[model samples]
Target: MQKYLILLAGCPCTGKTYLVNQLQQQFKDSFVITPDEAKILYAESIGFNCKAEKEALEHKVWQFYYGVLQLYMDAGKRVIISEYPFSDKQKRQLSEFAEQYHYQVITIRLVADFDVIWQRRYQRDRSPERHLCHIMQHYHYGDTLENRNLADDLITKDQFYQVCQMRQYDQFVLGNLIQVDVTDFTKVDYSRLLNELKQIVKL
Candidate 1:
């Protein structure tokens, strides 16, 4: 059976997670992987004190992340991986994996207006449901609020502007390129997007 490798690239708060969730619902057997969820699981496994151990924790988390990806690929499972900002090196790595595994690849890039992203980020940071690792990445270990300290900004507005303007997450095009403008989530036609992807790779 031919498997597929779906890669999603986007900046913060651009709705990559939302699209992944929808895809998972459509393709129930496909494996979905994200770094944030991986970090959370690893932190929880070690009793959740990761502030002082950021570098060590990150190393372990990525090791586990790629390890799991390899496992699914070896098993010939359809995989969907999401990245905040897919680097050039990572794109090359995925291309190699697709070649080795004989899997069709589809890379989707999601984008949004900076103001829309900022507003979404503001709300998400304030929400109690925000993950602990994300909080620890920017603020102190015990800090629950992401916007409490301006000096400890997660990624400054200027930095985010540069990334977006420079089209950093705009080039993971190893296979078919699907660019999605997610400034308005409600306006997104997920069914159409899914159907388009289905035409490219067997769901």
Candidate 2:
């Protein structure tokens, strides 16, 4: 049987970790890999700030986690990887890996309002060694109104909306992807979301 790989891609403070924790609780047999855990493990090895250094460390971290994911998959286990799949390059790499392993990849993008995230970041207590402002400024993973224009020529408004929607929907009809807006989970019908996920995978 092929292993199931659910990749949770989202911005910080968007409840990715919360959802991951819930999933782990519900599915005790599944393996969960989170970037925050990786950062905590290798913080001393990789200095803070220094975009280049951070990028290198992130690459190493992802590679390590991906290897671990492959191990679980090889054992026919379900795995959940929670990370910010920001760039197109990273997504392509994941797609390639899935193709190579013949594993089913389900990507979930969690999103929230910028102001909400900003406030969340501000309220979050960080170690004295790390500055919250610096971290927030440096983390560039989401599609915002400012950068949306960068790719205006390549995609239509509707297509772009679909791309934004991909954050939630995962896969599109054209096999491109869908975006799910979880702005207010309290107002959203979570049962419908669960049903949608069930339809996609046997989980």
Candidate 3:
């Protein structure tokens, strides 16, 4: 089996998670690394509360995430990193690693209009499925984390819009780029997407 490093990059609420699930189903043996899940598990192992010690959590998550990525690559497994907005520095690092390991790199970037992205984020904020750590970090405002509810996500909404407007969440273009328009999830052609990906990765 040829090894691959599949990088899913996009802004928040851009349907990366949904694509991750689709890819997982399509490629059963491929290893998927989700940073959010990694953060949660690492926090638990270290007795770190995201609500209380939020400052260093992201740094820790990236460190652990990169280590795990290298390990899987060394083992010659297909690795998928879901929904990361990689910085330029990170992209260069990944490029070097991919070249060293002879792994084919595929980058899938999901994009949508700001309005659509906001609507998706709004619904996600109200949904019970969203993890508490995410809510506390993104949605927390003047309210205490313990007493906060999902009735409002004002602060994060404004911040996210501004960030997206400036394209902060967009990552640098990398190997075999496939840009997907996901303004409307119902209209996204998953079959065509899978076929396109299969052609490039030769899956």
State the weakest 10-residue window (summed lDDT) of model 2: 169-178
Question: Ranking by lDDT, best first?
Answer: 3, 1, 2
Best by lDDT: 3
Q: What would the TM-scores of all predictions be?
A: 0.83, 0.64, 0.83
lDDT of 2 by residue, 52-158 (tens): 65666767777776677666656666554445534454567666666666667776666666556545544443333332223432332331333322322233335
Candidate lDDT (C-alpha), each: 0.72, 0.54, 0.73
How big is the positional error of residue 135 in model 3, measured in Å on the Cα after superposition? Answer: 2.1
What stretches of model 1 exceed 4 Å from their correct place? 47-52, 79-83, 137-153, 163-167
Clashing pairs in 1: none
Q: Which one wins by lDDT: 2 or 3?
A: 3
Tens-digit per-residue lDDT, 12-46, candidate 3: 88888888888888888878887788766755555
Candidate 1 per-residue lDDT, tens place, 52-114, comes to 676577778878877887778888886555555675757766777788888887788888887
Candidate 1 structure lDDT: 0.72
